[model samples]
Target: MSAEKWTPDHLQSAENRSLHLEQRRMQLLPVVDDLRRLAREMAAVVKEIDGIEGDIPGQAWMRARHVTKPLFKAADDIEQAIGDLGAFNTRYQRSYEELPQKRAEKRRRKALAKSGQPEAIESAPAGSGSPKKDEFEDVFDGLRQGA
Candidate 1:
């Protein structure tokens, strides 16, 4: 019997599914970015209100109240958006993980037909170099020494 050959259709299906998930992930990224920006703006507004409280005596109280309401509302919206982004991220991660598995399965099927033996799994080897330190650690260490 002739050796069975793997077809393009299986690979194409996996590629299509991966592309679809990627598209969904891309769509959510902009919304997440916008929410993050809004959150930062709200934080800035809170700081501005705090600064104004010390400068302006009577009117600052009323203005702070008004500013706080909207800031809280914006914060709420940011929280919801962050939750949505987290869910989207989970789905994106799952799709990303599946894509590699599908590709590996296709390769295994081809190998089984050609070699008539179980396919061997390959993985990246561990690093040989020393571990790297985070950038913030150096700055914090300097601050601690100065203090």
Candidate 2:
């Protein structure tokens, strides 16, 4: 079911999922921060290596540039994963604390039903005549008699 229509059990499950995602986000933060630092370091190293020799495309320059691509991409991917986990946590965190109360209310009703208690009828059963029949019954009779 959609998150908006979640049952209490589903809410608890969603809350657990968010908690797990939050944990994953926490674990990934340090790694991603490290990767960002490393990417910055790679940029500095690339600039340094590029300037070492004048206008000569050496093996060091080529290797450095090639390695930088994957490192930067890895950093980008980690950043994206962190963002996703954060969004998931934000979406489901409230549900974690709200479900138990809802579930209890649901259980109370279920228990009441299992006890065979008669539920109050808000409206009369179908095909049953109106309860105020006598109040209206003389109106038409009076009109006809006056005519």
Candidate 3:
């Protein structure tokens, strides 16, 4: 089932999943910060290595440059990863905050369905009927409304 589809029967599981997302986001935040710091440190080291002078042999300097090339690239990759992780964490946090409203909305919809009321469809925006979401989509599915 889609993660956001939290009916009354699966409310506990929904809450647990939301808590898990919060925990995972918290855990990743530190790692992202560490990676960002490490990347900056690595870049500084690379800069220091590139600035070395002291009669170093031509071949040795070339090898040093070669090794530092990958170090720079690694730092860049780490920065990209940190950005992606931070963005994901932001999204997770938003989803966690919105879970209660989503749960209430789902419950309301289910109650309407059970009562065979047409207000459910009428209450929804015109041409905005809910569509099935992919299981692997981001947690913001609840807010997307099939967009």
lDDT of each: 0.57, 0.67, 0.61
Could you give candidate 1's per-residue lDDT for residues 51-117 as a string of tens digits? 4434655565565566556645664665566566456546655676677887887777667657655
Better of 1 and 3 by lDDT: 3
The numbered model that scores best in TM-score is 2
lDDT by residue for model 3 (66-113), tens: 655664566467556656755754665467667778888878877897
- Model 3's lDDT to the true fold? 0.61
Error of 1 at 74 (Å): 11
**For model 2, what is the C-alpha lDDT against the true structure?**
0.67
Best by lDDT: 2
TM-score, cand. 1 = 0.30
Q: For candidate 2, lDDT tens digit of each residue in 1-147?
A: 333543446434655666556666777878888988898798777867644455565766676777787877897898798787667556565555567767776676667667766541222245654578788887789788878
Q: Which ten contiguous residues of candidate 3 have the minimum total lDDT?
A: 5-14
lDDT of 1 at 80: 68
Clashing pairs in 2: none
lDDT accuracy of residue 13 in candidate 3? 50
C-alpha lDDT (0 to 100) for residue 102 of candidate 1: 78
Off by more than 4 A, model 3: 1-65, 124-147
